[model samples]
Target chain A: MTSEIRQFLFESLTVMKYSTADMDDDTVLGPAGADLESLALAELSLRVEDHFGVRFEEDEAEMFAAMTVGEFCAEVARRVQTASAT
Target chain B: MSRGVAVTGIGLVSPVGTVVEEVFDAVCAGRSALVRPPEGHALHGVVDVAAIGPAIDPESVIPPKDARVVDRSIVMAVRAAEDALADAAIEVGRDVDPYRVAIVLSGVGGLETLARQAVERSTRGRLGISPFMLPGVLPNMAAARVAIKFGVRGYTSSSGTACAAGGQSIGEAVRILRSGEADVVVCGCTEAPLFPTFADAFGNALALARGWADPTAASRPFDRRRNGFVLGEGAGVLVLERAEFARARGATVHAQVLGWGATSDGYHPTTPRPDGSSAAESMRLALRDAGLSTADIGYLNAHGTGTKAGDAAETMAIRGVYGDDMPPVSSTKGVTGHMLGASGVVEASIAIMALRKGVLPPTHNLDDPDPACDLDHVRGEPRTTDVAAVMSNSFGFGGHNVSVILGRAGG
Candidate 1:
């Protein structure tokens, strides 16, 4: 599931014309080549809400900065599953 | 050396048309490019297709690999620059020294791609982030891309001074050329803020016309019923050369960029000062820079976004600067909506066209003018007049105000 989410993110970035060749789990997202700016991030978040069926608070921007790609996918998968359980 | 910068070439991407001829024809014929949106996507008050132009074909301008790294704004900028170079009959590597060419582009928003990427990273993960995002999202990327395309090694910079970005960019280019930093400069602004986030943000601020059902009526600048401005996206670029250099090269000079003035309100983050002092000062300084008086200007291209505050403030500023001898004023926004950073350049092109053709385009959709905006707004049909000099105004968010003065060559 984590890999699946990572794939989804990667595909979306490709659609936005961002190069993904150098992106890795340890790559810095902020001030990096293809990292979305604050404005772009907000837009991407809304798209994710529709695609993943998960709602995220504004504070998630910080958490997003700290997590790796795999960790981010796990967190999203966990949230989606928890929401289904509810 | 004491004269104004020469306008040798112009490139525009507006709703009316992409090329200069198409836009000029549309304006001259009093044609409104606004249309009704097909089917369910209805915007209130604004026209459905206000001056929509052709899409930027990247293949025609840049290679596929390099084009992939650019956003909409950069694509528009490069295309316009290419067109301008062609229009000027300038062969980049042969006709002119690449080192003496400068590029100064302006924009309001950088890249919508970044906004989309952020959402993906937050929802999916950091591993999803692309490596090309930062370079793609920077404001200066448009200028950098243009330089790379043309092999221009001189000064390259970008300004994000909101709506005034276009005028300010052109003004800065003029200064650079005058100061001998570069013999020729390509200056303009591009904007592509059609993303949902931009719409929502402006909608939340009540800056956009709420009536999505009628995009045609959505943007009514200077109309008594006008509410707010309709969001727009496009680019306008101009080639500026030192007077002596242009004359020496036997270039066809369209008009002279006599002077430019830029100022900040220092009062509001998103609104103009009520008294219009800063806006007035900007125009005053521009006229002073040109060594001309109010009586010398024959036309005015107003930054009339149709917003209540914006129109009133601009009107007051014009009255303060020109006193009783106000020139014919028109807001092309009624036709092009508001291209944000590109508005100044687009309007400047219109002014130049007016000078070349000896006619002034009308302010469309201005049926019943607000009493506050009482200037002689060229309305209904294009007016025939021998325009010697024209003043174009552009004020943006953050209290940025810029004015440029262009005169007929040999004046």
Candidate 2:
């Protein structure tokens, strides 16, 4: 699940036209790293929601930008587990 | 009689070309961009025919992710605006004051985006709506996006004068410059009404060209067999600066906007006044403002939309204004199809190019001119003449009429 989440994360960023070459576990998604803005983060969150069947709020999507790629993937995996268990 | 507005740069996106010179060459060579939407086209099987401009590469202008959210129409306008600025070699805050530049663009609001989004939301419910939908569907977003992208801080406006919007926007730019509100003005319009739903409106109203075997032959303005105007999608942008401002900056001058006139029919919403008295007044007002008489114009780019009543009314209007010595006239719509609001600036750019080349482009499909539209129609082939000045007119639904006069720089 973690690896799949990571793959989806990189693929989404790539499709969004962000270069993920230098990105890794420590790189954040916001200005500190990939520099995705509010709209872009919202779009990325929606894409994840569509793919994983896990929902996210608008405010939660903005918080995604502050998380590192590793942390984001982990958060998504936790949400998917919680959504499917219910 | 009027302040000379210098056209320093032109960016034109049409069925023929995107570069001003390329579009000019195709128009001069009489190549038609009108064609039936090919299979798999979004409008294919919906509208019988149209003049579709080249598809813009979204990634070129916006980030791939953001491209999906921003309206296609806005991106195209921004690209054209950028090209116009590059052509003029003017940079806000560096070459000219950022606060002294105005952006006035116009078009039928975002029918394409709105119609499509409405469909998606209907099928999927509330969550289907995108966050950027509101800004994408706003009519003023064209001018707003241009102003935002370029950091233009001066007066920004959008005209909703229907088909006359493009001309009125330029007229408004001249007013803004003359008001001492701006030094350089970015003026133009963008339209992308190619959706199936939008096509249905014109198709149902019987306002679209139909039953033509060949799409290129669909739009025949002033021709005896003329039926209706073919829908076209594109944008036109031009950078206009004060004549002295352009001269001081040593910018290349494409043409000089000597004068402009705008009027209303007060008759009908969709149909023009049959007697064309109000339309003729528009021409006379333009001439009066330019301090030129009827004999001064070398060619007239008419608002002949190939419709039965529109061509006749415009012809009567021209005859009422110029009578027997009417200048050589043509309607490039036979080649470009009707671009609706975008036609005015595109036609004005074509007229400017015609003046510069001393060659008048002929009406593409005007093989048999109607007796009602009788005048010296430039047809069969391009006419070679040392024309110094030209006129381009645009009339829209709701009776809006605009006539703009262009002349060789300092002529």
Candidate 3:
């Protein structure tokens, strides 16, 4: 599930036109790394939420740029499990 | 502050094509870009015919995520702005002070973006809308995006002067440079108004050319068979620099904007003043400002949009200014269609090219000239002339009239 979430994030970043050839689990999702801005982050988060049937809280959306790829993927994995259980 | 201004660089994305030389060649050869939008085109069924530029991928300039959010108007503006800057070899903060540069882009920007976003909100709900929608849809966003792309942090603004916006931008740039506010200005207009809703407005108003089996012949400016102007989309940008500064910097001067005149008809919202008194006044003012007599201007780029009222009024204005023996005149709109605000600068560029090449681009589709628009029309074939100066005119729906005079490069 974590790998699946990571792959989804990679595909989403590619679609968003972020240079992800050197992107990795440790890569920051935004300015310091993939360079996604607030708007792009919001778009990526929404796409993830819709695809996984999970959601990012308002604060999480704001911190999207600060989170690493691994951290974001793990968070989405947890949310997907929670959504399924609920 | 009446400082001399020179057009050092020109960037155009018109129906004729993007490259400056190529667009000039197409115009001189009378190649029409007006046609029925191809099947599966966004405007295929929205309107009958328009002078449409080639398909552009906004992502080619902007990042995909951001490109998808912003309007096509921004994309075209940035492209033209880039080309204009490269052509002039002017870099903000390097060649000239960043604070001493300005951008005066003009047009009804983001119309297609606004229309598309409104539909998305209706179908996808409010929450599904991107937060970037508003920023991307504002009329000034095209100018803003270009400024952001180039780090132009000077007196940046846009003109909403309808079809005259493009001409007004150049005029405004001259004003800014003359005032010593900026040494260089990236001035022009961009438009992406080829959408269904906008098409409906013009179509229902009986303002669009119709019943033309061959779309290429639809935009017949000054022709007796002309019905109305065909709409077009594109951007035209000019890198205007203070003449002294441009010469000092060893810039490649294309043509010097000797003078410009701006006026208002104050007549009607949609109709031109039949007498074209104010429009003629603008021409007289431009000639006077340029320190030239009517005979000095060897070529005239007219504001003839192929519409009966517009062509006739412009003819009156031209005759009122130059009398019976007017300079060789042509309206490129016969080929380019009416690009609204962008037409002003694009036509100005064409006039400058004509001056440089000693060849005037002919008015396409002028098979039968209207008696009311009787003038020295450069019809059927390009006219070669050794002209040192030229006048380009642009008149908009809001009674806005602008006539600009350009002299030979370095002269």
Model 2 chain B poorest ten-residue lDDT run: B61-70
Across B1-411, the per-residue lDDT of candidate 1 in tens digits comes to: 645589998988887787776787776675656555334432333333333445677756766545665677878888888888888887667877998999999895455877878887898685456545766788888888888888888888998898999999999998999898888999999998766676667767878755545566666778888888877888999999998888889999999999989999999899888778999999999999999999999999999998889899999999999998899998888777788989899889989988888889888778899998878889888889998999999999999999999999777
| Residue-wise C-alpha lDDT for candidate 2, range B34-134, written one tens digit per residue | 88899988889998799898888877776566666667677777788888999999999899998899999988877778987898789966556666677
How does residue A60 of candidate 2 score in lDDT?
97
Q: lDDT by residue for model 3 over B82-160, one digit each (tens)?
A: 8899999988878998888999998887877778778877987645666677778787887788887888889999999
TM-score of chain A of 3: 0.93
Candidate 2 lDDT for residue B126? 57
- With a 3 Å backbone cut-off (N, CA, C), the pairs that clash in candidate 3 are none
lDDT agreement with native, every candidate: 0.81, 0.87, 0.88
Superior by lDDT: candidate 1 or candidate 3: 3
Tens digits of per-residue lDDT for model 1, A1-86: 67777788777667655577888756544455346655445545555666788888877754566556666677778988888889
Rank candidates by TM-score, best first: 2, 3, 1
Model 3 bad stretches (over 4 Å): A1-8, A20-26, A48-60, A70-86, B63-65
In order of appearance, the predictions have TM-scores of 0.81, 0.92, 0.92
Better structure of 1 and 2 per TM-score: 2
Q: Give the C-alpha miss distance for residue B369 in model 2, angstroms.
A: 1.7
Q: What is the TM-score of chain B alone in each candidate?
A: 0.95, 0.98, 0.97
Candidate 1 CAPRI level: incorrect
